[model samples]
Target: MKECVLLVFLALCSAKPLFRPSYMTLKNMMLKDMEDEGDGDGDVDNSLFPTREPINSFFPFDLSPTCPFGCQCYSRVVHCSDLGLSSVPSNIPLDTRMVDLQNNKIKEIKENDFKGLTSLYALILNNNKLTKIHPKAFQTTKKLRRLYLSHNQLNEIPLNLPKSLAELRIHDNKVKKIQKETFKGMNALHVLEMSANPLDNNGIEPGAFEGLTVFHVRIAEAKLTSIPKELPSTLLELHLDYNKISNVELEDFKRYKDLQRLGLGNNRITDIENGSLANIPRIREIHLEHNKLKKIPSGLQELKYLQIIFLHSNSITKVGVNDFCPTVPKMKKSLYSAISLFQNPMKYWEIQPATFRCVLSRLSVQLGNFRK
Candidate 1:
């Protein structure tokens, strides 16, 4: 038995030692085993493992280029106003209907810049630094209705505007002249406001508004010394206030039969011809305040529909019976027409008391001071 044990020990010592790997070698082998268990395409089968999204995917940044960075998008309106934008933002959605980019520093509008935004209707760029607008800038937006470019630095009215436009407000601009073809295609326009422009009366050529059927036209504060000629007869309201017009000719508003409101306040008007307002039978309101008139304007009794007359802040000193009541007494029993005579030097004792009461009964007169 002792000899057998010695032989066994010698055999164990001589045999190659069993393959017992070191600690690092065993760890490497285990990692290799894990790699071998993965799919051959280098992608591990994470279906059983807990999945997690990348940390960067949870940010608030927009990756699509279809919308601008800071614009607020609603159903069909994109308001990028007051964003310190230097130009009209691109990538406006195709479904956008209105874009209000007002109060920006956009200097010009290049043609076809809004090409893809065909659904746009109202583009308000008011109070911008716009100096130039391509004639075809609004060509693609044919369905556009209102274009507000007021308070800009445009020297001339933009041409080739969309005919579908109903209201065009370019007030407070530097537009000096309106050519004959300035508004040729804008036939559907209803309101054309160009007030506070340095427009010369002669710059408006004959037939400048020939084909237009505009109802409300505002050309106030344009430095005009007289009424502009060839005005559209379809005008319902004509605002020519805050100008240098000193006299009103008889034929100034003869053709405007549909005119209801006429504004001539804040002007240097001192003389109004006898028949200047006789033809306008449907006249309702006339603003002649802050003028240099010495007496009541004639032909006020002809306006059967006249309701309000503003003649305050003038140099008038007397009131006549004929100035309030019509010669035929057609409007004697009608609603009293308000006549503002405040701030005048008319003394109640200077005029006949009976005549004054008669005029007051037919019209509502506002006096400065009176003593029975």
Candidate 2:
């Protein structure tokens, strides 16, 4: 028995980590999403969302029209990405549906840049050096839908964006303040990603998200110290991970009734006010990993549709049977799919199986090996 135990211990020490330690796995989630969407080699980015949703809205063809000098033109798409250009190429075909201008040195977008692209559906200007955009730059492209302006040097959201826009990725910029009516009349917008900016709570003006029905919004890696209350009430997914948020208050999520997926991981969150999550009765996934939480937040059992709860890499020391599931098991609407409690300080042996009675199975529950 001693010989077998020694062999097992030796085998364990030589084994590598089962999962990537810092890859942001809310079920294999974002940050990787940003890379997949940043690739320009593909004809079209299959992933529209910076997290999960795939891009299925565009289909490029082989019909070539009036192409710019050094750009690739095919179908109704113009591919000018990854070039060392300093300005928007001229004579772009009028019927171009999508323009790929990412990874360039373009510094400004003047009024005549997109002067005649009336049929333009998408414009990608990511990974550029843009600083100024004329208020009327996108005036003629009134039919534009998807816009990728991430990884730029913009100081604020561009003015006079098309009201028909659906997905807008302006993350990884130098934006600070978001004035009111910034997204006004953008009723068709559903996804908005603005992570890696220097925005804070005070910089966001009152009613900043007014007139927006955008559902998925990611403001991760920002300087925010608390949740922005002015976000759209129709939000289904809100990812604020990697911010400086220290607390989750009751009023922070009072108006978001349809919230489903929430990402608050990698913050300074020490406490989540009781019933703060109950306001959104339909919340499904909650990413609270890598925070300073001392215990499981109160009132989780009252949530009917809660499935995934990421509480790993925290200071939790205990687990109660009724803390996650209601006393009456039938009150639960959905079975817990995943419950991550790794990297905490809790004693694994002390946690009983009854604690996860609502879970799908023991394999679905990730526990044990709580390192100090």
Candidate 3:
């Protein structure tokens, strides 16, 4: 009886950790590891680095999203720019809103790269050597709004763009022709920039921008000799500077009746047909500097909203009094805030004071000698 009692005492001593003395079960506490930045000591006592919580080991929940390799994530924004990555990294968070991948060497975007990113909005991939993008790369990204593909080696615009895209910048590429279905369902797109391409007059097909309601369009520094008349009529601003345009015809801006700002500077424009400015009654600012015009464009006085005009660095030799101001001096909605005509061959003294009667102030006009 003494030997059996001693054996029972040893068993009870070994089983003390399984239960309390009152026959109650004890819950075990859990500790999670923390990430380090390689510095040994962070604080004075290093106690604030990681804390031990009293969370039970039974319940588990992954609170934070997994960040991709070599990328920084905060507030649902992933910044992977300038990382010299050749391809898209794996395991991007599903709740990512913006992914900045600019200044990398990524050549191609695969189909399933952005498969599960449902909440992605903006994707910046500028300054890369991208040449191709799989048609279904952005298929799963339904809520994507902005996409930047500038400074790439793309031969043409990528296909299968999302319908919710609002902004697209594909400038400085080798695109020469744009088909009619390039922006077929992009009705939400309002801003489009495709400058420094090899596009010309016949490169853009008819109805190329038919389905789009873009408000701003820029195709500067290209091979355009004449204005593209097939652009959307709802344009508010149009920029086509640094091109090879030689003249402006009457029908060049007939469709752009709602245009507010027009940029045609740094071109070879020698003349603008009479009544061409009547097409845009809402015109507020016009840029025609560095051209070859001999005189100011006609029908400027009829523009009720005309406020600024840049005609510097041209071959203009004269400035008429009725060029910008009306003869009747009627009530106008907007007056000229700035009229730049410097670097022209015309003499400032030759221009009459009545030429600037509708200007805002004496400091509104800019005049200088053309030192050829």
Instruction: Tell me each candidate's TM-score.
Output: 0.78, 0.82, 0.83
Error of 2 at 145 (Å): 0.5
Per-prediction backbone clash count: 0, 1, 0
Tens-place lDDT per residue, model 3, 242-337, is 999999999999999999999999999999999899999999999999999999999998898999999999989999989998776555647799
lDDT of 1: 0.79
Which order, best to worst by TM-score?
Answer: 3, 2, 1
TM-score, structure 1 vs. true: 0.78
lDDT of 1 at 314: 83
In candidate 1, position 329 carries an lDDT of: 50
lDDT of 2 by residue, 1-372 (tens): 999999999999999878755522432454356466664544342222323332222324333346887788765678999888899998898967789999999999999999999778889999999999999999998778899999999999998899989999999999998888678888899999999999998988998888788899999999999998888899999999999999999988898989999999999999999879889889999999999999998888888899999999999988887889888746745788999999999988988778888888888789868765
The TM-score measured for candidate 3 stands at 0.83
The all-Cα superposition gives candidate 2 an RMSD in Å to the true structure of: 20.2
lDDT of 1 by residue, 316-349 (tens): 8887866755656544523335778777667755
lDDT score at residue 237, model 3, on the 0-100 scale:
99
lDDT of 3 at 71: 87
